[model samples]
Target: MGVVYIGDRAVGKTHLALELTSPQGNYVRVFLANQNYQNLRANLLNLDGTTKPTQTIEKRSLNVEVRLPIGISKIAVDWIDSPGELFRRSWQSEHINEWENFKEMVGKSEGIFLIVPPYREILQPHIESENYVTQQQWCNRFNRWAEFFIYDCSQARRIVICLHKADLINCEIEQEISKLNYLPHGSPLNWLQRHNYVVNNYFQPVKSELEKINKSRSGLSVRCFITSIYYRSLLELPWIYLASYL
Candidate 1:
């Protein structure tokens, strides 16, 4: 199944891309093209500094295969490094060719990953400031974006909302997990519990919107992940569960 990664500019998308290209313990990334992975790594750093700004193109796509995964023979990934402007400018307003390409990506995607970074840094500021857009406004806009993507890609059975830079969050989720008595209060909660809380709090609304948009879409599965290419590696995580499906 092909999977696409969607997020605004500089939210660890390229970092995640490069990490999988390394000699992974669980899997290996096979680039369909002959482009050197080393050059792409350097390009990531330059991209971040505006030295090489991402162009407003349809996509910077790479046909890749994460081969010999734990539970599967191979996982083919048609990964695209998309422009932040597509979502920022609301491309559907004009129904441009780029927007059509986006539609094609969503239409063909079996799984989707939406990367969300810390609000204060990538999105809006945590506190109100003079000549700055309100945090609530930014939130509303993001929510709309999520709803729109989910609607357009409603048929995608598996969706991953990746919360990037988890260390930067203002209200630590671990602290909030304390107040809830229903979920088994334990020292060092497992991934399932954390994922459930995070998804319910953030992704449920978007899932609901998706259902509303396409009432007939069935067996939809959306997962929330606290993903960091730095703090932790996804390769170590039991992706065999996901690989089995592929």
Candidate 2:
């Protein structure tokens, strides 16, 4: 199974990857390192508090055995992590070969992990904001991706839309959550606390595009997740979801 991570630059793809592969404990446990995923040897941070964006493509593999109702199945997962710039319209022609390679890989992959950041910051219009992505702009961009997947990537069966940076979404509740000692993986209480914030502000804006993908492909599986690097289970579950089909 091939799973690729796709998101805008500075949205913490590298940071989230590191956290999943090299977990720190507060509330979350069952580290992915114990499950076989390892951190990449790339810079995760800048001098400032922002994550350093991926500049080139990177790949990793995990071969693990998962138990299913039928029996224990051995699965090998291929992860292709790439620079966010590859998704930009202006960059494609400049890096034609790389862009072609990227498209080819996605067309052949089994799953896609699409990371979306909190919309509170991105939805606010700022003419000078280099990184801010408006709702319309994001929707249009991802709609194109959806079209490509539907028409070209017939092999891609799972699309996991991860609404990352959950800590930044609801600051007040998160502060309260910070006081807690532990929270189990896939806790409904944790998701209930923040789902409305992300769903109404982030997911709703892109809902139409996502719905179109669903209607167009009967076999494709589309899932949304509210995730944070601080939460271990949130990051780990998406990989397990992708692996189940394999």
Best by TM-score: 2
Q: Name the candidate that leads on lDDT.
A: 2
Residue-level lDDT for 177 in candidate 2:
41
TM-score of each: 0.67, 0.69
Error of 1 at 164 (Å): 0.7
lDDT of 2 by residue, 1-246 (tens): 466666656677767766654435332222233343333433445556466556676655544343334555554545566776776778887878877887787778777777876653443243234445655676776777778767877787787787777665544535434432123344334332343344555588777777777677668867666667776655555555555564
Q: Residue 34 of model 2: what lDDT?
A: 32
lDDT of 1 by residue, 185-239 (tens): 3424455565576656544434554344335367665556655555323322323
What C-alpha lDDT, on a 0 to 100 scale, does residue 106 get in candidate 1? 73
Indicate the residue-level lDDT of 115 in model 1. Answer: 70
Clashing residue pairs in all predictions, respectively, total: 0, 0
Model 1 CA RMSD to the hidden true structure, in angstroms: 6.0
lDDT of 2 at 39: 30
